[model samples]
Target: MKSITQLENKKVLVLGLAKSGEAAARLLAKLGAIVTVNDGKAFEENPSAQSLLEEGVKVVCGGHPLELLDENFELMVKNPGIRYDNPMVARALEKEIPVWTEVELAYLVSEAPIIGITGSNGKTTTTTMIADVLNHGGKSGVLSGNIGFPASEVAQSVTNQDTLVMELSSFQLMGIESFHPHIAVITNLMPTHIDYHGSFEEYVAAKWNIQNEMTSDDFIILNFNQDLAKELATQTNAQVVPFSTVEKVDGAYLENGGLYFKGELLMHADELGVPGSHNVENALATIAVAKLSGVSNQAIKETLSSFGGVKHRLQFVDTIDDVKFYNDSKSTNILATQKALSGFDNSKVILIAGGLDRGNEFDELIPDITGLKKMVILGESAPRVKRAADKAGVTYLDAKDVADATRIAFEQASAGDVVLLSPANASWDMYKNFEVRGDEFITTVERLKG
Candidate 1:
């Protein structure tokens, strides 16, 4: 394990004072790193910022001045909320100072092996599934990420023999220099976080950085069904293993209602606790990582058999009037929402969408909304969503909040209808983050039941 004592007296600049950023700053300060926490937003005006300062963190809020960063620093750790093009980051690059994401910083001190998962969609599900598989494989101390926990925070508390699985965002990948994973994953790429990266290509580049930095000694797992993932494999030097749900895969596949790895049957479909075709793909990635990690077949089956679905990825809440309410607030991208839409047979679905604009175009799903009964728009991006829904000639309405949207959808719903909260944009304009946004939606729907 890397010694925390080695970072003593090291001058570290921690960017953005969110949970990950604040966690990084606190840990660094405890390790004796002279940490200065900075946020592009204001401290007095933002409660989150104010809390960080109240906790005794040296804070530079309401935008960072480049002059404040001119001095030599050992390292800069940034939150996933900070994109690569931020002015401070550009300046940091010019100065040739090492910059890392919270995940990278956590790994530097973790004795546990990293199992990284990234994709435009399904990252959270895949990460959780992989962690479950590792735990079932009899590897104790299984954590999502050590020190930098979104779900991975448990990694820091576990023993070295434990396995660590990380759901990495592109923002996290952007700042890494030499961070490598023992088992890396690309669930499948699609357009996401386009507003931050300025373009889809740039976003893809940041995601590809994870595999690009790995050597042949490290293994890469990807979905063969993703054409772009196949193309990306050719560009990287790592050994590529592929998995698919719709067809036969070289590394893993689904057959006869069961999941198989290279002709080796690992699990029955009824054994897996997760549903949807995407979950099947997630299972494959988990099994492949398990195989490479020397996990036994029986262990993999046992782990998968008892695993439950993630919080906001197509989570089933309750059925009211035969209408299934699914909380997929975690699907903050058009591609992710599209995947959620694909999970069920199109009959009557009320898709509650709209949030902070993330440079996304909704035209891709317009032609495919044949079964969409209605669409409700809410939050900062409501106007944009209404515009797209109007163009598609679909029934659309603007709601004040998630509750309003749910109520409207309920009034318009029929038996066997599906109420889906899959906002294809960030939640910052109206809420603290996606988790809050999702919780609000779930609470609203449950209230309707009463």
Candidate 2:
């Protein structure tokens, strides 16, 4: 790994003591940087900040004071969730101080080749699949970033022999300066996180940041079906490899029920354990990354057939009374929910949806719900989603929460029906994150089954 000596004695400010923030602060301290951490949560409530304080780092809690900016820190490692609009962040930018995310620090010290994947959907599935493919091929592949493990923590342990496969979000990408991945994959870009980015154009631009530092020697896998992704080919110096579900291309393509790479059949599309054509796209991207990483076709096929998919993503919870229940709580956007619904035959589905609104109009989701047998709405966006369901002429019921939604859906569903929990909105209004939201749905389903 590269030595972090450059950061030694540099004054660094860490904002927000989230997972990434904690790791960055600890790493900075280890590198002998004067690390001062500021978190909005009080010291008693912020365990991460408390840990840093025990290590002799300066910990400021309860709020982000403007005085912190006057400390003349050389750099600020702000949490990805802390937007540029934050007063401190804006002030830091005004003072010409570099504001970075934890990923930037990880990249600066990491010795391993990195494979970064980003998109509005299917990033987790594709990132996990790529790591699995490499591992099956007898290579050490470390998974991190937005998938759970902080990239900063993963980078510390990875060596030149290992491959760091990261699931990057646009939020994480925005904070990167020189963070470049050897192999970058953009599964597909959609208008998402409008709440954070303030516009669709800005969101798309953030996802494109994955390739910002790539050179010709690097490789970028793009989705042929997404024009926005395809248009990015000219913007990067990296070699572009496109994967398509519609037509054959020079890269990976799905034709005649088989996945083909550069005109050679790799595996039958049906052999893939994950459902949905979106997953086919995810698999194709994984295949491209595996092949580029020197993994054998056999290993790729083996991983594809065995990889059931990541949790909270079209995960099959259980079948009680012959009704199949699926937890897709990770579908925190309109397009994701549409993709989830497309996986099953429309008429056999009873969908449970609604969550943090994010000001997204559900009118676009109307057509996707046309085939649903029933719809159960809950959380903050229930009223908005209910209006869309009404517009689509789909029968829907109102519920107070996921538990209520699950009970109502199960009651409305019959044998041979699918009860799907695919909230098109985020869980921030009702729960901690999508994982917690999904777990609650699973717990509720299991209780009913018992």
> What digit string (tens of lDDT, one per residue) describes model 1 on residues 339-366?
7876443335788999998766778866
* Candidate 1 positional error at 311, Å: 9.1
What is each predicted model's overall lDDT from 0 to 1? Answer: 0.76, 0.87
Every model's TM-score? 0.66, 0.72
Model 1 CA lDDT for position 391: 68
User: Model 2: how far is 323 from its true place, Å?
Assistant: 24
Candidate 2 backbone clash number: 0
- lDDT of candidate 2 at residue 40, scale 0 to 100: 89
| Model 1 CA deviation exceeding 4 Å by range | 4-8, 40-57, 145-155, 309-450
| Best candidate (score: lDDT) | 2
**Candidate 2, position 390, lDDT:** 88
Per-model root-mean-square deviation over C-alphas: 13.2, 13.4
